[model samples]
Target: MDEHSTAAESINPKHQALIDRLSTRRSATTTSSDTARPVADFLSSFASSKLSIEQSLSESRSRADLDHISSLDLDQSSFDSASSSLLPRKKFSFRNKPQKKEEDPKNVAEISVEPSAIDKISSLSVRDGPGFRNEKDTTLVKDFRQCDVGQGEFTLSDLENCRVYLKGTVRALFFYRIRNCQVFTGPVLGSVLIEDVSDSLFVLASHQIRIHHAKATDFFLRVRSRPIIEDSNRVRFAPYRLTYEGIEDELKESGLGEETGNWANVDDFKWLRAVQSPNWSLIPEEEWLEIADISQCK
Candidate 1:
C-alpha cells in the first residue's frame, strides 16, 4: 500500500480511455483474420483444378503427334509418295473393243440345151389355182410285172415316183394319146414334159433329172381312166457305148443310138427321154435288156 497505492493514486482518466481504444482494435483484427483464412483456402483449391485440366489437354496433343510420325515407312519412296501425297491422281481404262464386218457371195455356172429342148412346159397339175384336178386314172403295177420295153431286170419297187431323163422329140402323135386320156397337166408340166409313146402304156418323158446326179425316173399311170398309181425306177443309161442286146437293141430300133448315149449331147440341145413302165421287158420296144451305164443313169 505504501508505493503501489501511491502509483495507482497517480493514474489519469485519459490513460484509461487510451487502453479501451487499443482493446477494440485488437477484437476487430481477430474477426478479419477469421474471414480471410476461408476465402484464401477456396481460391487455392480452384487454381489446382484449373492446372489439372490444362495438363491433361497438353498430354493428349503430344500423344497424337507421336502417333502420326511413327506410322510412316520413309524407306520406300513409292510408298511414302502414296502416303504423303497432298493431291492424288485418279486413273481410268476401257475394255471390249468393237468388231469388224463380213463379206458377200458370188455366182456359179450355166446349163446347155437345144432350142426344142428349152421349150416351156406345156401343161401340168397345179396346187395353187383352179385347174386343181386329181389323177384321172390310177393303176397299180405289182412286182415282176413285165413292161413293154425289153429293158433289163427291173422291179416295180423301182418305179414308184422315180425321176427320169429322155433325149427325144415329143411328137404330135404322143399328144393325141395323152390328151385322149384323163391325165392332169399344169404344175407338173412346169417342171417336166411327156413325149412320144414307147408302148400303149409307157412313153418318152423328161423330169428333173441329171445323169451326173443319177436321179431316178418317174411316171404316172391311170386306173379307171384316172391317175391312181405313180411309177418310179432306178436305171443306168450308157447310150454312148450301148450294145444291142435285148432292151438296148429295142432302144436302138426306136431311133435312139449308142452314140447318142442315154443323154443326147446334140449341141446346146441335150435331148433326153423319160420312160415309165411296170415291166419294160414285156413291151416289144422295151424288152428286158441291160442298158449300160446304169450307175450313171439319171
Candidate 2:
C-alpha cells in the first residue's frame, strides 16, 4: 500500500468514521444548491427570531416607563386637587379708580373720640368683680391687709371723679374708663392694666404696667418692668409715692422693695422715633407730690 493508505489504516475506526462523514457533508454542501439552501434558511430564521425577541423587550421597557410616568402625573394631579379643595382661593381685582384725597390731621383729631365710643361699648359689657365698679362721684376704699396671700385680681372700672384706695398686696389690678380720679394702691404682684383713663393721678407699684388710650394722666409708679403706653397723650411719670401702714412689708413681699428706678423708663408704642415721645414725660421734681398718705383715705 502507499503511504497515505498506510496512515489511514493506522487511525481508530471511530475517528476515521467521523472524518469520512464530515468530508462527505462538506462536499455535498459545496456541490448541491439544494443542501446549501437549507443551511441558509436556518441561519436566516435564527437571526429573525433574535431580532423579534430584542424588539419585544425594548417595547415592553418603553411601555413600563410610560406607565410609570402616567402614574406619577395622576398622583400629582390628585394631590393638587385635594389641596385646592381644602383652601379657598382668594380673588384680586384691579381697577383704575380715582384716589381719595388725604384728610387733614386736625379733622382726624376732631373725630378721635372714637376710642371713647369703643370704651362705651366695652363698658356696656363690664361685669361686676372683686373690686368697685360703676361708682360715680364717690369715694371707695378696700383694705386687703387681712386677705389671703396672692389675693385675686382687683378691678376699678367706670369710676368718675372718685377717690380710690386699695391697701396691701394683690395679684393684679385693672383700671378702665376712670376719669378725673385719684387712685392709690399697694404693691401689685403681677401687673396693672389701665385703659381710657384721663385727667387722673395714679400711685402704684407693680411688676408690669400698661396704659392705653389715656389722655392727660399722671403715673407715679414703682414697676419692675418698663412702663408702656399706647395711644396715650400728655401722660407723665414719676417715682411711686404711695404710703400706707405695712406698705413697706407689702412691697418687700411683692419683690419691689428696692427703688428699681424703672418708673421713668416709659415706652410709648405710638411714638417710635428717636426724639422724646410726645405721649409721655418725666414729672419735674417740683411737680411731684409728696408720699400720699392713703391710711386715712376712704
Candidate 3:
C-alpha cells in the first residue's frame, strides 16, 4: 500500500510541473501592453471582417459541414457550375439613361416601299417613348410643360381617329400612320417627321418639317424653313394658331417664338414645276381656326 501511494504522488508532481510550464507559455503569448495595442487592434479588425464575411456567405448559400472533414473531395467542374450563378451583374439606372433599342436603317421612309412593310410592321414592336402609340379611337393628352421636355424626343405612331395634345417644347418629334386625328403641340427644338398620315389636322412649330405619303391633311405651322413633302397630295397649310399657358416661354427657348411666315413656302418633291405646286396650298384666312386655347385642355 505504501509503494503504490508514493508512485501516485510522484506522478502527480510531474503532471503539475508540466501544467505550470504550459500556463507560463500561454501568458507570455497574450498581448495587453500599450506598446502592443496596434497588434491587438489589427487582430480585432481582422476577426471582425472575417466574421462579417462568414455571415454573408452563410446567409447567401448553405455550406457543407466541415467539422468532420479530414480530406478534400471537391469536384472542379461542379464547383465552377454552382458558383457561376452567384456572380455580379452590370449596373443600370433607367431614370437617368433610358434603354434604347437598335433602330433599323431600313425603316427609313426614303429607302423603303410602303407596300412591302406589312410583315415588318408586325415586327416593329413599338418601343415606348415620351408620347402615345398603337391606339384606336382614343383621346391622348401629354402635358410635358412641367418636365425637362427639351432633353427627350417624342413619338406618336399607329394612331387612328384620336385627338392628341402635346404641350411644351421638345428636342424632336416623330409621327407615323396617323389617320383622322387632330394633333396640336408646342415648339419642337429640332425637326419633325411625319409619314403615312391622312385626313388629319396638325398645329405645330418646329425648326424643320418633312412629310411623306400624306393625303387630304391640313397643317398650321410656325416654322423656321420651308416644309418638304413627298408622295403627298391635297394637303393645305395655314399659319400656326396654337396657344397655351407658358407657350411663349417654351417657344422662345426653342427659337420659334415669332411667326416665321415660311409655312407658305411649300416644296413638293413630286412637283418640280415653276408654277405653284398643286399638291399643297395655303388655306384662306377665313377658313383658319381661331387661336387654339389649349391652356384649359389638361
Clashing pairs in model 3?
none
* lDDT of every model, 2 decimals: 0.27, 0.76, 0.75
Clash totals for all candidate models: 66, 0, 0
Model 3, global lDDT: 0.75
lDDT of 3 by residue, 115-136 (tens): 5544443345444676788898
Ranking by lDDT: 2, 3, 1
- Candidate no. 3 TM-score: 0.58
lDDT of 1 by residue, 165-267 (tens): 2221221111211212222111111112233212222222222211111113222211111111112123222112222124343334434322322232211
Backbone clash tally (model 1): 66
Better of 2 and 3 by lDDT: 2
lDDT of 2: 0.76
Question: Residue 219 deviation, candidate 2, in Å?
Answer: 0.5
For model 1, the stretches where C-alpha displacement exceeds 4 angstroms are: 1-97, 100-250, 253-298
